[model samples]
Target: MTETLRASAPPVATGAGAIAVLRDLASYVDARAEAFSARSSWLVAAATHLAGEPVVVVAHEDGQVVGLAALSVTRHRGTARVTLLGGELNDYGQLHHDGPRAARALAGALVDWLRAQRRWSLDLTQLAPEDPALAALVRLLPGAVVSPGAPMPRIEGVGTSYRVKRDRRRKATGAFNAAGRDGLRAEKLVLDDLAGLERWLPALVEVRRARDHASGRRSQLDDPGVLAFHTSVVRGAVAAGAGVVHVMLVEDEVAGFVTVLVDGDTHRLYDGRVAERWLAYRGGTVCDIEAVLRAQDDPGVHTFDWLRGWTEAKFGNAEVVRAGLHASSHPSVDRLDRWEATARRRLKAALPDAAVRRIVSR
Candidate 1:
């Protein structure tokens, strides 16, 4: 076994230097089967439009970069708060690293550096439960508040259970039959035209919005900033051939689309939107199943990750369910954030879906 030689650098402010480090780390992570969220393109896209100051720490061994963590720092009433970079944008958070060993070393180095800093609060969310970094942090920080996060569902090849496979087949068949009966031609394609993509993106969002509105739920792509960030990510991914927009057209009209990010042998289901009118025909599910079928046929793809969310649509194809982590440590802010989150959840539950949507819209 090679002995680990660890050296940590001072926090680098967000800029070209930080981006370069992220790119290097992303390349390292991408070469392995690491989370797609940790890929270079996603990190760069998220870092470019950070909501707070970024503090990037790079770790090295034998003068070679091994791992890094990008953090966002914000101040409220003179109290500094730190969070994982692009926490909102990521489905899983882990320090970008070479592998498990590098992950452990980098996590230790990061914890040491953070301990040396002045008074500040740390809130790390969307952390993968088995992530070595997360394990190290939980072990080192005793008083940290650790919470169970959302479940991320994923499909392993076809499906593990007969029920799941049956559901998927039923949906796929019924959807296609419905389209045929309605005289609507349906086709799914790997969209590569940049100009056409630019035009269709807004329409996609609108379709998503309409679907959500019909369901009396709030849309994730409602914010302009969020839309802009997604655009950057989509464009970057498509340009590099690491991503593809699978569009499902019905009778020459847009019915639905899914944005997929390919990392190594895994194809992540990043974001999707379906026309409200096409919901009766399971347009969204058809688009997703089409991607899943294509991925299953590919010799390279081993996993179809639905990233995060436990929607019924994901369950039909999902064979595994993974959970994320949320941990927080602070002298003054401990438990407050968690309390607020709980309150928000309760309030959302108590209100009607349409009322909740109205509140979110305003």
Candidate 2:
């Protein structure tokens, strides 16, 4: 007999009860090596709390949880929009499923359920281009608008060595030399540095705030919730052996920091910050090159992901593209989203490279 799979957004009690369920579901589906962000219980827990009125949809087969999707429901101008949880913090938003068959089933059930809801429109954003759920949604809802999100640049085949281009390598070497001359040294932060992380977190926030201010842009670190979420994630991920933090110090003073998530053979550069004053010493570039070199030395690491964005300085040697995905149920919303996307592309194309970078980096 074929396994019967059913998807439902079961009501969950607020606070502790919801957290437990989210953790359980994350652990259940996180067994796969490629689960990355989806498998992070701490991230899920943070997202659930951060997303106002969270709705968790799970697919059950033979009474076992086989797939799950977390969403945030918010009303805007009498129209309710359901978005993937975690907001801008999430690099990719996709359903966690056991297999392709289960994925299709889960997607169908989810679309059907969303359709039956009141004043609701589905908005799936920042999904991987090849995410099964994206294809499933397109097939299920022909009227849904699909658009491109930011580009994800990654360096493949990092197990034995890195594949930096000649010019980029020379530039990195120059930065490293400059950093050494400036008395800057790079070091990895270990589990014992949990307390040290507490001190460093604020410094990183300050660095980011300073940089953003200099560029006339708003920093997400200004938000207490984003700050708290990252603090929770870094602590939890480091304790779980799923992440590491690398820092550049100049004679006991922190100059820059980078956080990375390790998943099987892949090392994802999640976030980083460099003090504005240290820019002249090329502290940020030096720290990043050091981190990449360390990842290359790790026998278990085969790929280094720069995450979302396309920057020549950092991702000039990117071997693969991890495109983001988006879809909307409302026709007007879909058209508007597409228009915005098109406008962004056109503007990017018309502006100078440096101006484009400033616009996107803001």
Q: Best candidate, TM-score-wise?
A: 1
lDDT to native, each model: 0.69, 0.65
Tens-place lDDT digits, model 2, residues 101-207: 77787788778767666445676766666777678877887666677767778877774545555665577667656766766664434322566677677777777
User: Which portions of model 2 show Cα errors greater than 4 Å?
Assistant: 1-18, 33-35, 159-192, 316-329, 332-362
Candidate topping lDDT: 1
Candidate RMSDs in order = 4.4, 5.4
Clashes of 2: 0
For model 1, what is the C-alpha lDDT against the true structure? 0.69
lDDT of 1 by residue, 161-263 (tens): 2123566767776886788898778776667657767767777778877777666666666766566777888887777777778787787767888888887
lDDT for predicted candidate 2 compared with the true structure: 0.65
